[model samples]
Target: MKKLINKLLVNHSLIYKLFLYIATIILVVYLFPKGGQFKYEFQKGKPWQYENYYAPFDFAIQKTETEIENEKQQITQNSKHFFEYNEEIVERVKNEVTQKSTEVFQNSELSQEEKLDLNTRIATILATIYQYGYIEASSESKIEKAAITLRKGNKIEEIQPYKLFTSSQILNFLNSKIGTQPYTEVQNQLLNILYDAIKPNVSFDEVFTQKTLEENLNKISYTKGLVSENERIILKGDIVEGENLRVLNSIKNEFESQIWSKSNYNWIVFGYTILVALAFLMLFLFLRKYRLDIFENNNKVTFIFFNIILIVLLITIIVKYDAQYVYVAPIVILPLVLKAFFDARLGLFSHVLTVLLLGFIVPNSFEFIFLQIIAGIVTILTISELYKRANLFISVLQITFVYFIAYFAFSIIQEGNASNLNWEKFLYFALNGAATLFVLPLIYIFERLFGLISDESLKELSNTNSKLLRELAEKAPGTFQHSLQVANLAEASANEIHANAMLVRTGALYHDIGKMDNPMYFTENQSTNVNPHNELTPRDSAHIIINHIIKGVELAKKHHLPDRIIDFIRTHHGTSLVYYFYKKEEEYTGEDVDESYFQYPGPIPFSKETAILMMCDAVEAASKSIKEPTAQAFDALVEKIVNKQMEDGQFMNADITFKELQIIKKVLKKKLKNIYHLRIEYPE
Candidate 1:
């Protein structure tokens, strides 16, 4: 039992990866639509790929989106708008007008016949205005010069509304009606009082109108006609066009929607799970084969998985809400982030696979996949350095352009004209490009969350004026200068062999920071002829020399440097001996000295950058001692040192090839000869 637990603990990383893959597969499969898929693939302009197709069941032909939209719009346009006739308002206006007219006539200078005739005329005019109906002010736009239907009690009548008036317009309407007739001052006063008493008797029936509109919209037939069973839809080698295309799509929809039964639903889910699992498996296999270094670290593997899942979830959610906006989700962000942290190949590969999965959910699956895959390729190719703001902006612009061009090409092929292109999709692509710029800050966020480092961070760390590098210059000027020379050499060597020059240069700058603890013990910081190591025993001097690696690591940690930079300090010396003191101790005692006391505690170089630093560091420090530098002498020195380090197994763990080492050796020799001017100005 104890042995089994120990074995489990030893292989914990593998187990974590297994669990991660399974969980990712399950989550992505769950995100897929539960509906079963149609087996046939059809396109409008392309010939039918399947055998002669026929309607297997009695399913009705479905309407296109444009057809459905047109139907609903026609319902809104042709259907009459209804307005309510307020009987209460009309009745109130009648009583007030009659009472006020009687009061005004009581003080009139007219005889009874004149008063009665005037009262009858007023009543008739008010009745005419009310019969025409005054609509509410808020409903003006709904009945905007259009014919309105007036509903009074249980009766409905359609009216032209040529004389409709709101509350504000009532006074002008009353004046218009009475301005033609001669009237007494008392008669005019009564008309004014009746004007205040009348209210808008017509109001838009908003609730009823909306309810009717919805009912009409719902009653619209989504299916125009039905296809009989066993009817030949289209023959093989026939281009699907017009009604034939519509019928085929209708049958596919009906088949997919109707076939989702209890037994088949689980089968669909299982099939999706298998496909999704296979995609993830391919990604893992590619990582293990091509990126073994990244594959070994579980953190990096988890970070990669997180990025893939991030894009998948983002696109999936947007598609679920409205598939029309799927292009605006910024699929290029996946490759941008991965390329920033890892490499372009991995980024592009992951993006392609993830997008293929999204094709199942987004509208226009073929167009979407092709556009995104091409965009991913463009993103990886254009953006070499992510730290520069201008580079990212330009790359994003290029990526957006690629998206636009690919989509335009596809649109023209299908529609056969640029006029038929959906220009609205170009706006979405522009937004996608704009959103891709967020990768710069997003990378910083990833760096913080995952404890990862990127080119941006490396650029910042490589700055010579930073706090740590500045301190190294102040306390140990010679070592600082030595680090600078090593940085230049390692950077050049890295570039020569197609390795990471920026990373190698940055690592070289901090590799000797450990020597800052006691600068005089090493010869580099000795300005005056006083040596601090003369009074101490050989072992003591060796101990002080070896402790610098430990001290540098502590200072780096104290200053919160990333672990990637700290690895350089730890592995620069690679367990090589402090041979100067060991030889002196042997001469003084005439006996063998213990090698352990003179050796640096090392984990060796584990990457191309670190291994290059190891070679350059040793060569640069040793070259300063050559008094009579020559081409032959520089070549001999570089060869001897690199060969000695290789013999000591210093580069066994590093991912460096022998051919790459030869290239680096040539670069170092050329650089050394150039430093001392041994080589001529022109190469032979």
Candidate 2:
């Protein structure tokens, strides 16, 4: 069990990576829409490029969305309205009138016979109002309906609303009923009484009417016709329009709908899993072959996979809700963000792979994949110097424009006319462009979450007035100035070698922070030329010199600087000896000494940028030591120092080549000559 545990513990990072890949693949596969792909691709007005196709089985020719929408609209226009004639309300109102009649007419100066006549008139009007039906017409949605269905008890009748005495017309109808005679006070009183007593018996039954409307709509067939088995769908080179388009769409529906069978479902998912895994596998291989540092760093690898999954999950949810908005997913943000954190090549590669995986789910796989990959390419190529806000905004705007142009071209090709292009899709592109601007904040968030660094952070750290740098400057002004010179030299060399110049420059600025703790111990900070080293033994002096590397690392951590910047402090001297102190000790003792005491403990530089810092740091510090600063002397100094470091194999771990080293050497030599006011020598 112990041996097994040990074995399992070994290659922990490799284990984590494998798990991440498998988990990513599984999650992406599950997010995919559960459907089989239609083999043939066709569009309206476009010629069918496939060979002559025939129906494999009989299938209903389903209507297009436009056709379905049109049918639904027609149904809505023609559907009848149903109302329930509430007889109970009419009875209640009539009972109230009857009970109050005696009280109301008691004050009237009328004979008993006249009262009887007035009561009979009231009863007659009540019967008439209920018989014809009075509705609150304003509550009805359709004001000009030709007819409405009235349900009273178990009986149903169709009647015109316009012909009925509506609630709005109650007063006019009552006044007209008291007709033609000059209006008497008693008649006017009775008219007002009737108006108060009459209630709308016919009320719109929204629930029942909607139910009936839904039933009618449901009865409408979605499929207009059927294509028989072995029917030819379309001949090769024939335009897919009219009947041909409908038939092809019917077959596609049949194929997609048939994916419900367990066998087919499993098989389809299996195929999807394979394709998704392959895309991720290609990404892994790319990282391993080209970006081994990122490949080895599990956090960065997880960060990449997290972005891919996040994008997929976002688009999947959007597609599940409404596939029409899938294009608005801001797919270009992936490339933009990755490029900010990593490099352009990695960013573009990851974007293409992610887009390809999305192709499995988004509608119009070819078009979506093509547009996203193009936009991603645009993102990687056009966007640079992401520390600048204007650059990101401008690049995003250009990316949006590319999306529009490509989509318009595709639409024109498919429809064979620009006039038929859908304008709504342009809104989606605009939204996609807008969403891409969120990459700025997202990069910052990822930077914090993954403990990663980006150009923006580098720029912020490169400021000379930052807290840590300021402390270094005030405590050891000479070392701070030395750091600035080294920073400039490293930056120039890095630009020449096509490495990350900003990262190296920032790293160079903070490399000497350890010298701040013991300012007088370093030669640069020794203002009075007080020989402190002369009072101490050679070994103790060497210990103090070698101790700076260790102290720098601690100071960097205390300052919460990014590991990338701290790397310069750690590896600037590598494992090379403090030769001046070591040689002095050896000359005094004249005996063998433990060489380790004179050396800075190091992992050395492990990347091109770090390697460039190492070279620049050594060259800059050594260049200041030259009393007779001549062009040839500087040249020889650069060559001899760089050659010795190379002989010591300090850069063996770094991912830099001899050609790049030579270029960096030339840059440093020219910079050193320019610094000392010596003219650069030209080849004769």
Per-model TM-score on C-alpha atoms = 0.95, 0.93
lDDT of 1 by residue, 561-653 (tens): 889889999999898999889999999889987899899999889888889999899999899999998888899999999999999999999
lDDT of each: 0.87, 0.87
Q: Identify the candidate with maximal TM-score.
A: 1
lDDT of 1 at 149: 78
Separately for all candidates shown, the number of backbone clashes (residues 3 or more apart, or on different chains) is 0, 0
Clashing pairs in 2: none
What TM-score does structure 2 among the candidates reach? 0.93
How does residue 299 of candidate 2 score in lDDT?
Answer: 95
lDDT per residue for candidate 2 within 506-570, as digits (tens), equals 99999989988788998888889687988999899988888888899999998799999888889
For candidate 2, the 10 contiguous residues with the lowest summed lDDT are 135-144
Off by over 4 Å in 2: 1-6, 99-120, 140-142, 179-189, 678-684
